[model samples]
Target chain A: MSAQPNPTLSVALEHVEELARGLGESGDALALRERARDLVTPLVLPDRARHLWRYTNPERFVPVADPTVLAPVAIAHEWPREDDLAAAALIAGGALRMVEIDDTARRAGVVIEDLHRAATDGLLGSLVPPEHGFAEAINTAAWHGGVLVRVPAGVELEHPIRVRCVASAEPVSVPRVLVVAGAGSAFELVEGHVGGGVPALVLGVTEIAVGPDARVRYSLVQRWDAGVTGHLTARARLERGAHFQMSLASFGGSLYKADVGAVLAGEGAQAEMFGVSMGGEKQHMDHHTEHLHEARKTHSNLDFKVALTGAARSAYTGMIRIAHDAGGSEAYQVNRNLLLSEDARAESIPELEILTDDVRCSHGATVAPLDEEQVFYLKSRGLPHFQAMRLIVYGFLGQTLQRLPATTRERIEALVASRLHEE
Target chain B: MTDSTNAVFSCADVHIWVGEKEVVKGVDLTVMPGEIHAIMGPNGSGKSTLANGLMGHPLYTVEGRLTLAGEDVSALSADEKARKGMFLAFQYPVAIPGVTVASFLRAAVSARRGAEVPIRDFRKELLARMADLDMDTAFAGRYLNDGFSGGEKKRVEILQMLMLQPRFALLDETDSGLDIDALKVVSKGINAASTPEVGMVLVTHYQRLLNYVRPHVVHVFMDGRIVRSGGPELALELEERGYDWLEPAAAAGGA
Candidate 1:
């Protein structure tokens, strides 16, 4: 046993161990339980360290207080027992409001269910990979409860349904999600986080399974409070002819690290990931993404842009892998950063690993600051320094906004303008 | 005081140094309102430097008095001088990304006027001025000069000059890269901005622009000072004879 781990971490780990045992006696559940037992040992605690915990140390984020005294609480919702949108409802926000999934989805032969019931029915263990060390360990150890979402075959939904998770009065919140979309189904999912005044942490893990011929648009908005730290990991498997579109916006948080991955398990699978991150003050935001092409005729493109101001810092590392049999695959990745101040820092690394010569793959990275001549030109037109900076910053991040829906784009622009005012 | 008494801009014994290279040395220039004055010189003759100095660029060290509308503006920032009714249509305008030309002009107008102009009136004025320049309506929505064609960028600059309505304007090589049609349009725009209350200093390396702009006074700038001041015929003469013949004459006269 590891010298009786820190009180805050020990209790959290103990809670996860107990919960993993109750997640049903399946292959994933048994594997997670065995892993949970090892988490308290010296080998897992000190010997096997994680680069993911480089900042916002997990021990500090998750306090190890007694779990027996913990309260069983569910977020207050406006509607109860509603499954309007397709896809199994996975993790609901701590301060979430349940809404009707809309009449259009109900008429499209889509079946929507809650994650709590899915877990009770043993569907959760089958979706989550027991190999995700930190995220899996975090969820198996400490997730209070979550949602499950499933989209029926051949259903198409026009409007995107958002599941906003706002944090309040919690030092640590672990959220679990499981999403399954059937073949030929199309839907949009937005997972959002909004934070308040509390000093908090979020360990978020999401597992998505995209069936053959399905199209999924997933957007993650991390607008945490300045007092919070977040560690999020999301993974998806795309079968034959499926498409996955992901957009990530990290606009807040003192420290955040997000690990996102996509596995192209079938032929003709395609994935496109886009992200924009803005950091201020002493904030640090890091993103790591991987595209694994295990089959032939797969395609993937990744674009990540980060703007750093004040003394903030950001680091992005992205990789694309083409397996030996994954010939004729096209993969491209780019990471660009705009430095706003002398003290602001940015690091970008775009890498590709290919075992097949028939594949077309390229990766590039760039880091630059606001052009002084451009600022001078604007100032010469009588705009102040701050106004000029705002203009350039907005343009630098406008590419990501162009990837969003019209209404969502407007809302994001308003949010960015409001944040600039705060500065 | 009716015709030549406005004294739009006056520079006395202006000596400018750009990082130890004395570009404009002991020059004197004055432009009275309602008259178009052209400064014709070859490359590296400090014509653009004089224009930039009048706009109060920090890069140039000024050793003389620069007065705009009879007010001393030698010590102001470039933007401050611009707000004080002095404009420079740059030789190569820098593209300011993320800023629309319309919004940039509105901000500049508000800064110059020292108050917020009503949106309705501002919009009306912007449309009127844009139409006057024969500019495409789509130009207003574009990021300021970003990825603009050479001719299109110059038109945008002229549009800004007309909207600001400054007391004195400095046209720095505005006709450098323009074709005949663009040159005609640009000259028309300059003429439109030249009222009895506004004066202009047109700087160009080629005297071909002088044919259309029709300057009342033409000055030859060599080693910064006005080496020779004459009627518009001097520009025509320089176009025929070139600067080699006058360099020796000016040198002899200076000695």
Candidate 2:
């Protein structure tokens, strides 16, 4: 690992060490925290010419020195069907606060508690891989006061678990979430992220471990403000015969990068991933998705769509990897970009690594402006110029929008519509 | 030439060009209020081109003057002309995958009325119009024209016409792919939208639609020019004899 080029980023690494020392713990938690702190200085910055860093600057996400505000962020955004949720949690200042669990889920052996306290149980960092990159290590070292949700085997929760995370600038707010779905259990999760339009950084990490034969549906919507530079990594690891459905939506941010992937580790496991993002003004968003087939007879599909307007830019990369032993696996990936204006730019890249000859894997990508026939059709119906453009953009992202979690569906939809009207 | 001051829709020496080639060559027509004119022709006769060109489709270049209710509208854009009370039922209405039928109609109605319509009033009006067309009412919630059958597409076109209530409408092959029941339902929608103030131009390759909705005047369009114009009897004669003789008549009349 090379020395940090920026003095401020180097100070950021010292701060992580300082934070780890402040914990003053012994045993596994201290080892994990110190390991992350040690990794910060030795980890090398990704090269500019690398595939993941080709479109976006890697230095923008390096956490800078800022006053760590420990107060909880004010809840300003709207959520959906609040009363019907099985669990509702507010995450900010690296601490999970104001969490409530329904009596039904509580009696059914669903556990929702503080992550730091749960760490001693040897569950923290269980699903997080040891070979993670810089952002994942930084999150592990800096984040605290997060949530750990555990659902016991054979228990099914009818209502979705809702989590609203707010990260204030100047604090380098890092929110961590970990979920464990037991075997033969079923559950749904809806997460919302907000607060980031300042000079500071917001890095978040989420990991889901789907047990054998478990069913899980997870969705997240991001509504950060412009000028907020954020980095988030979300991944799910599936066990034998498990089924997982995931979605991620990003509507606002100055520069936000998301890495969402699913690992099909169990035979006959299936996963579906859908992503939606909209960029306007000077917003820059980069999204990367991966579906790794590590077991035989696994199936996976991914669809990601981005609509860019104004001078906004988006870069999307989708990857599908099949291991040597994963014969008879099927994987498909599709990325579509809708450029609403001439000034707005989009880059679509597809990456695939198939080690086995018996697997079926394919990927497709397209970058196009608004459909002329579609716009003409709308205009002929007496819709004005801007309305026609808005309708077309809305329709371009329709597939992912329709796949959002039911609890966050209404709120996310209204936010998208309001953003379209502003343009 | 005497000016028909009360004519709702009129075009003078209209020529439509698709790319470098001329499709509709110097065709002239006038339609008055309370009138339904069938522009009948066989395949590739430019009937659809004429219909699309008159409504300001971008792919076709039109050279002529089009007037609606005594106001010239040839220089305006498609949406502007639509706001000026002109509508064209497309031969192949494009599919908009995400926008619901109800929402799309709301936008169209809002554009025509120059303001946003109230939701309650819009919903009531939409339900009533759907009932008038014998539609399932669930169609309002579906994405606009996406995955819709051919008959359903035509029905939605008529539904748009009913909602917009334009003074002049150009229907381009609205009956080509309809079954018997669907054809009747669409015919009913067309009839319901045709009021005394509306002038309709129905372009068809056959007289199938005319059997249900009687036309006051019929024009036999051959090779983009109207070779014969008469009362409703012309449509019956063409339906019986077919369009095979039109080339001879077109040649004989030097059209």
Candidate 3:
């Protein structure tokens, strides 16, 4: 519980005060700002000694005291349109630039709007409590114009909703999102983060609520420039008989840290999480995930794969916790890492805590270099060295990537291939 | 087979070392076009080492000369040699979990031809070859060697040989784990690919494989060197009498 003093935290705290003063008399907004202030006071910045932050250095991120410092930048809106099932929202420089929902979805009572306005409507702040961590606290306090998405009860969207966030050349940017799936609603979401190589810092938070019997599939792809430092945090809750599926891919960023957690709070709830991360050329990427089964008959499964090369480093930690009352629950977790070069390094840790004898929990982890036999076999068939390596790396990651929605999976695969082939 | 005039594949005074230990001692071998030379030996007699060493596996330190079509390729890499019209059917084909068999063969075929093959033509050719080998068409969509049975893995290897049409090929224990039916199917594929311009060297530990695919010459490999060399009858004779009789002679020759 020792407080770790961080310049970035102090700067963020000061910025929160300025933002709170600007709110004036908006009751819910003012109340949320006050709660954020309270949460920031005793907040202890995590250090390398903390298990979750052991592989990530928080000092690398420089905080922005003034939200106005980031000038809005235009983002290209090129997207595939064959399915006509996609809705998109674009945010740039901490501001919502554009939001688009298909006519069918809009007519079905799906709400996609600015979080600042959503706050006044009493639809923000509850899903992501301010007391989560330093990153969450700062995001809750400093996010300028985040996006909020809500699908009404009994509505099922045919296609996915895409959210794209572009950070400007500014030294720091905070992006926030909140998603709510009403009871019996079904939808999918794809969130992407990208920016120019301007040595910036991005702090992002996403909160999701899956109502009873709702089905939601969410994916996040982080492809920031090599000069960016990204810290992304996410929390999700599942109601009775709800199904929540999530996938994450990290292919860029000089230093990236992601913390994601899911809570199965009702009977018969299920969660499946899959992730793939590739790091190269002095990059450091860390991912941490948690599954909390708080009710009986809850099920959770997590599989994460990572590949590192060229002096890059990565760390993955997954934990499954089954409460004493969560009898008949089943949880499985696996983390696999492949090191493509001698200088590359990776560490995987999978842990489990089951408080009930009737519950089933298992975890496994593996870290190793590329299999020489497989490479030789590919080469023996006339493939050049680089092609052989590429095929093997794709094969290694395809296990998790194949589980993603087809279009999203292909898009991420192309991004990963381009990043891997970068000189 | 020692007639260097028309020999498509030749190895002279080659020694292979894995780390500091020599796995293949000084050896000389030559295979003329249209001839199948079978190298028979007891278990752990360095048959695989010789095959891999000739194929220029990176793990082994090789000395002396390996030639194909009168060009010295002693320093060429595996892929480089493969592109130069040489192929090796691995004893244990490694599984590539996500790359489909069709994609891998297409790449290999393109590399061999130095150009891309049209999809329709490639599919037609692939399906025809697969049918000839009694392989199911569904395997083309499956991951290369991933979750494949032993017989299926061997069949895929021969299929690659047929598709690439290498001038010289080496089969390393390709018949080891296959049953009678699978062995015949694999052997048929190998025989069909053996043209007058292609030379082959099949390495095996038993004579069961030689029954399906006939070999013009048989060489008994003991330890790391060839202890005996003769016609096809040599394989049958060794099958009747185990390799124990040749151990003393091979040791004496080495000393």
Candidate 4:
């Protein structure tokens, strides 16, 4: 793509450059800044013509003026104790505020620190290539608050680590996370987003690397307020005998787009992706996911469910691609959507591209309203209409939630129940 | 028939319509507190439609008066009617995936009593009911009617009837798809639920179920109206002959 001289995009790009300049040049940070400068010119804004941007408009999330000029607002730490999360880190006002790691995890060689410091140590920007998409490019260039988590070899943490990013009236917040699970390591990570109901733009990305024989469970919960527009992207690479599972629960944001992809890059690698999204009251949520099988004896499974009410809308597209040399690979994808209101709508698309005939691959997608028979069944059992609908929706989304850890599942169930009541 | 004042469930000139087409013509029936009334009909004779309409299905427009224990309930929704001690066992029980049978039963029982039952008491009651129905305790954790066999669904429906203790129950084609063993098990559950305080209306196509749970009153339904009324011998006579023998009389009556 050639560079375009659009005034609005130019202003945003210049602001990103100015933010990069302020971070100071040091080791990997300097190299990343230079790369970001070169990439901004060719990174054109996405439009509806592209399938990835078909359901959303990128220009709406791009700030017209210099975002760096806005002053930071103080934000309080309000993590819920009921979640029982092991460790947590906070990012607010475009900076890393605090990080808390459990003593056991710290003693077991688990490292959780600022991404800039990791970048200075030449430990950033290697997993996620900068040229993948506009969001990634912008995040690489102007990321304000970022974190890196590394679990050394043979270390198994019993509790889940949570990283929360809250936007406190910032015009633009670019948050990033990089996770590396060393060989034979096992752990779980939970990433969350919360907004202050300001008309801000958030561009975020998370990169994961699961080493040989490592197992990782990662979840991303997006709960931005209705005033924010968010674009979140994630990518993961799994080595030999590595098992990785990732889930996303999206309940907030006026305009949200998420692209999460995983690649089984070595033999015996396994990956599973599951998600549940509830959209209501004129909200727009677009989700696209991919599973890439690049080695023999690799397996992947994906299941996503969405429930829409009021005038909300959602679009989901899933792709499974198997390389030519990847034989004995098994892949499955299923997407189901429930429309709870006449005005609510959803679209599901499941695609598969298999280059070899020696693989088992299947995909299915469905968009349907709440079954009247099921609703009447509940009503006949003395449940009111709203309660009947709620039960059915919870049942529909529970298929995905049941796959998470017990604590995570309970927390998400509570979040989803509250969201349903609010609508 | 007993006095109308003592009737637990009563209906008068009830007509059910789906859109503009009336499915159940004008019909009148009444059942005392300890009575079982069986309504036998041919296919497409509006047996199930009548049962659903009487339960206040939103799709059908029900006209005329319906009463439960001498109170007018003609305008109540299905849930409201259910809370007021009315229940309908569906012909085709819907499979609600991810909702455990135990949880659904608990919610229904709670709604009926207007208070949440303590977990210990609820579990005890559920286990006792399941044992009575010969159902495995593990079935309680499974999704409500999801992937359950035909007999299992009917048994669960009866289990709900026993748990909720509705004053009146309507069973619609509950015996349609079942083997002899399953039918007997389901019939045992139904018989166990038939107490003196709870009246019942069984809508069926066959008299086989009546042999297990004999009814005090039998009504022959045709073309959405009751063509004839008699006692238990009527079911045996219809079984000996056939519903074809009554079509002529029904047609003349309609004219």
Using all chains and alpha carbons, the TM-scores for the candidates as numbered come to: 0.85, 0.86, 0.95, 0.96
Per-residue alpha-carbon lDDT of model 1 for A42-81, expressed as tens digits? 2233322333433334444343443212344455433232
* Residue A89 of model 3, lDDT score: 83
Can you tell me which runs of candidate 1 are displaced by over 4 Å?
A1-12, A17-100, A106-114, A119-130, B1-5, B12-22, B56-65, B97-142, B245-255
> Across residues B214-250, which tens digit of lDDT does each residue of candidate 3 receive?
9998999988899889999999999899899899978
Model 4 residue B154 CA deviation (Å) reads 0.8
How many clashes show up per model? 20, 3, 0, 0
| Residue A297 displacement in candidate 3 (angstroms) | 1.4
DockQ winner: 4
Q: lDDT tens digits, residues A157-266, model 3?
A: 99899888886665668888889889999989988888844778888888898899999999988988888888888888999999999998898788899988799998
Q: What is the alpha-carbon lDDT of model 1 when measured against the actual structure?
A: 0.75
- Taken over the whole model, the C-alpha lDDT of each candidate is 0.75, 0.83, 0.85, 0.85
What lDDT score is found at residue B144 in candidate 4? 92
RMSD of 3: 2.3
Q: DockQ order of candidates, best first?
A: 4, 3, 2, 1
Q: What is the TM-score of chain B alone in each candidate?
A: 0.95, 0.97, 0.98, 0.97
Candidate closer to the true structure by lDDT (higher is better), 1 or 4: 4
Model 4, A1-423: lDDT tens per residue? 433546555535555445655654355575575576467664467646657777777777665544444355677767665554456788888887888887888888788888766642353666566777766776777777888889899998888988888866777888888888899999899888987556878888889989999999999889988878888888889999999999888988888999998889999999998899999999999999989999999999998999999999999988899999999999999999999999999988777889999999888888999898888888888989988898899889987899987767877899889988986
Worst lDDT run of 10 residues, candidate 1 chain A, spans: A41-50
Better of 1 and 2 by lDDT: 2
Cα displacement (angstroms), candidate 3, residue A387, comes to 0.5
Local error of candidate 1 at A287, Å?
A: 1.4
